[model samples]
Target: MTSYRWTMHRVYDATGNDTLGPAAISMWWLARAAAEETLQGSPLASAWLKLFRSHLSVDDPYWFRWAEDLAQSAELRRAYSGLYGRFVARALLSAHLGINRFVSLKRNGVVIPGSVAVTRISKGDIPDWIAWDDRASRHVLCEAKGSLTSRDFLAPGVPKCVKEGKAQFDRVETTGASGKLYPARWVAATRWVTDHRGGTPATLLWDPPQDHRPFSEDEAARHREAMTRAWLDSIAPGLGWRDADELLAPDRSRMAIVVNAEPGPVPPSQDWPELPDNDLPLIARLTEVARLDRFVAQRRPVPSDGPQDVADLAGAQSGSQTYQASWLPRPRGPEAKPHQGDYIAALATPFGLRPMRTRADFDLLRRAQDRARDLEEPAMIIGLPVGMDPGAAPAQTTWLDGAGISRKQDLAVFDLRRVKVDLLDSGPTG
Candidate 1:
């Protein structure tokens, strides 16, 4: 079998150029090309790759060469022997770094141990890198980069560096001949690491933007150093010569994404007992999705998965305003005071409810009261205005008399200042 070795060369350089390190960019192309091969026949992956292309420097001719090389390699008849080890290493880095939280762990705390004899996804598993069993509780899946001086992992936001320094990568570098310094070329390039076992792909995103705020250049360098070593250490445990059967050639047609990579739209109506109370918000969301789906269906297929894509479509639809104004009746009601003007206007508007003033004004409050009483629960009203003479004096309670519905005496009133009342039937107009 012929061997293909890809060495990182300085393709582009400028003291001020912060685009990507040459090694990083080249590695990115290789990893991306390999990642794309996983779904060669998939139209979905093709479309996604098209979207992915926009993120790259479109004018770069090397990218085209990289793509061509990947396509041609897919047709190779012999086993990819020499490049096998690099590919597996690439996959492990991709699996861990791609997650929101990125970290790697050691097995039995080894220092520069020889590559294990294992090859293939089964031995490596998916999301190839994971922390030691004890470390899982200490950190999240997200990865953060920072430098450590002595015992302290240094960064600005933190008051003090991690004192315990139990992180695994620390020991390996100190004992190994390579030491802690990450190969300059390895740290410079971006790679699309894949978890063949788990089938998830994430960019081994460790590079800072060259101008990271909050972090000094020295700090950023240290952070990158730590992350690079962590990634290298992750694949070290299972490293071995690649087996022809283990490597998967990129498939242009078949789309490959992480398991449950996309989420479905939430259902509108939930199952309820006997009579169901409508969930207006859920219904509104469902209705919007339906409307947008109908529109997109006519133009192109709406992916059953890809929740974010669906949301983007819905957001675009919602951003546009649709006015539906109707004729309003002439003002023939009683004149409103200065304060009442705002209240009156709000009532006239759509989706507006008038404020309850007098106890009798709580007529429509029956539903709320019924709900509260049925559950034998008390309710409190919030943000009510303070009115005049609220603590003046108590008024005699009165109501409709026998023959006709007429007030007999001042309605029962108490000082609202002293006690914090849980329930208020109604209150006077401010």
Candidate 2:
């Protein structure tokens, strides 16, 4: 399976030491994080999504092959290295440290009040990304660097990158809504190599002890509103909306989302569970293969088992059932029958967003849409195969075990140790 091995470190004065855990992360989650970071509300979101869908692989060494091919062109190689570096940094910070939302330094500097004056440093010295940590109630800054060079060269070069990133952070400043400076942490993430088995990403985090007030309730509200807008904008295309404005239109009758469930026997409704109402709008579980036909046509490298292997990996086994469920909006005043168009039947699968062609498939979705219109309060329909109990756990499979990781929906993470950490200054082991 394709994955990135990562390690975290803390730098004190002139010395650096490894922090607790090192691990491997699935490319699926990394690609998802990259999409959130760069494609939200972007004019080119569709194109970027297509690119990611084509390149991402979970059960093959496709990334290494892609990187090797790109290395033939110096310009493309440089661009890929920089972009991949930021993606890795975002993935690690989000999955490991719980910092999810991110805005480029350029965007944040302009949008946040009073940031322009505080971040007037030279363009080259600005940090790469800015994020808020609701758990810690503090802002986080990150500067990411990447290289595709040999290990001999990277041994010396990685520390220099970290040093320079720290210098950039030293020049940056930010403030919360009350006009007082907000507490912040700094991180410098470096992926020293790409296209090689030995390459592993590393981070240099400098979180000094400091006392500062958290964002006020009003400040948090505004921040949440902005982040929510960005999230909606990012997934608008995937949800078949023209844009965020159209998706958020007050008069719009239906809200649509595409959920990409993991490959395994379908679990009962109780095991799967319904998402909370507040999270419904943000509940898109995108899969790596948005369309299998297109994926095969591109002739991307895969395991020797060929297209069937790809199908299994993408959760599209033959004879597998597609299930649709609808959650109807609450009614008001005297109850009147909802219009036929008012109902929306969305499925939980990784397949392409297309109409079901089979007679049974068509009838199931059509009946679901009709039933939703008859409800008074919000209601959900859970679809299960004929033989399964409504409360049974999903059947286990050897696929995940073969990959050497625990499954969390489509996400898989594995711990690692003894990975090398080359720092300029020697420090006592932590």
Candidate 3:
């Protein structure tokens, strides 16, 4: 039992808020490894480590403010909030600051920076991050993506970072039982999820140019079935559980990843902190045990409880975009100008409808009616409801103005008579 504790904590207290616990600290290191390996020990990762330590070291506002602003930006929503959120944020800053020619600008500002500028500090509703190339009049937007497991990676398509991050490791499988080939993966590199418990082995991925966008789920799926089959073929090969167990024994030379020591793909570096000596042996043992169990699951016909979809847990459990989209209203079509558009519609939940409670509602309907009057082919607002009789009028009138942005008056009386309305999604277009 080598007591392998993180050695860098000696330089700075990275014990975390005491809430992260050993499990969290272990995952944090894995996240660091994921980034560093993908970047080949880039100074960016080194900087991220310093910033990350600040997050754990203290609650002081000075050290955390910038990080907090980046995390809260709407544009970095996916990259900043997920398990790999913090890591990606640091990477983005690294990328942005690396640019020598840049401007600090806000969202939708008409002025494009000098043609020589390499980066733009854009704020507001646009993409949270933009790397503009004024000379080319084109730019790449870097959106950081994070996932807890193979499923999340599968769910939203593999992000370029996640792919690169996961690809840094090798999970080799035996081509044949007697052959020295066996599948091994740096499983730790991909499962940096902070929000949920279970994680899947990241599907091995690659980006030769390192300038690719996030890959879709379909793209990843294209390789999954075939790869999964091949992996099973290499390790299981119809061998009984007992025989397969023997094949995966600890002394086997094929498995390169050991828990306590630097596993295959994870290079030992002075730049990075070390895992505790005691933790290494234990990590190694567990990794081996998991390796054996997973190997058997594939060799044997029984399922491996089929990893629960992280998304499923997300819906029943709540964490950022990790929840289910249940019972949501259908999106209303974009508002069209009253002059060119023909139909206006409103959704009237029996109780959600109420008479214009204030002045704003009344003005909205009046303006809409005025706009409708000017149109060549007059459009009527239709009120739709559930279980309503044909030709039945709505109790209250609710419709956006002709501009389609404002909610107008209580035309309850007109809704019952002149307005051709029904409690259905069918608007004029419908």
Q: What is the number of backbone collisions in each predicted candidate, taken in the order shown? A: 25, 0, 31
How far is 238's C-alpha from truth in model 1 (Å)?
1.7
lDDT of 2 by residue, 216-284 (tens): 775565664454344344444544455546555643332321112233222332112233465333211
Compose the digit string of candidate 3's lDDT tens values, residues 68-97: 322446655334334344343322222211
Q: Which candidate has the highest lDDT of all?
A: 2
* Stretches > 4 Å off in candidate 3: 1-87, 92-111, 116-127, 132-140, 148-191, 194-272, 278-430
Q: 1-430, model 1: which lDDT tens digit per residue?
A: 0001111111111121111111112222233323222212211222222223332222222221121122136433112211322233332233212211123223333222221111121222112122211111111111212211111111111112111111212223221122232211111122221112111111112211121123344443334333333432332221110221111123210111101011111122111011124432332243243232122111235566632112111111211011011111121121121111001000000111323332333343344435544653322111111221111211222111110011111011111111122223223222
Measured against the true structure, the TM-scores of the candidates, in listed sequence, are: 0.17, 0.49, 0.22
Which structure is stronger by lDDT: 1 or 3?
3
Q: Is candidate 2 or candidate 3 better by lDDT?
A: 2
RMSD of candidate 3 to the truth, in angstroms, is 29.4
Clashing pairs in model 2, backbone N/Cα/C closer than 3 A: none
lDDT of 2 at 414: 16
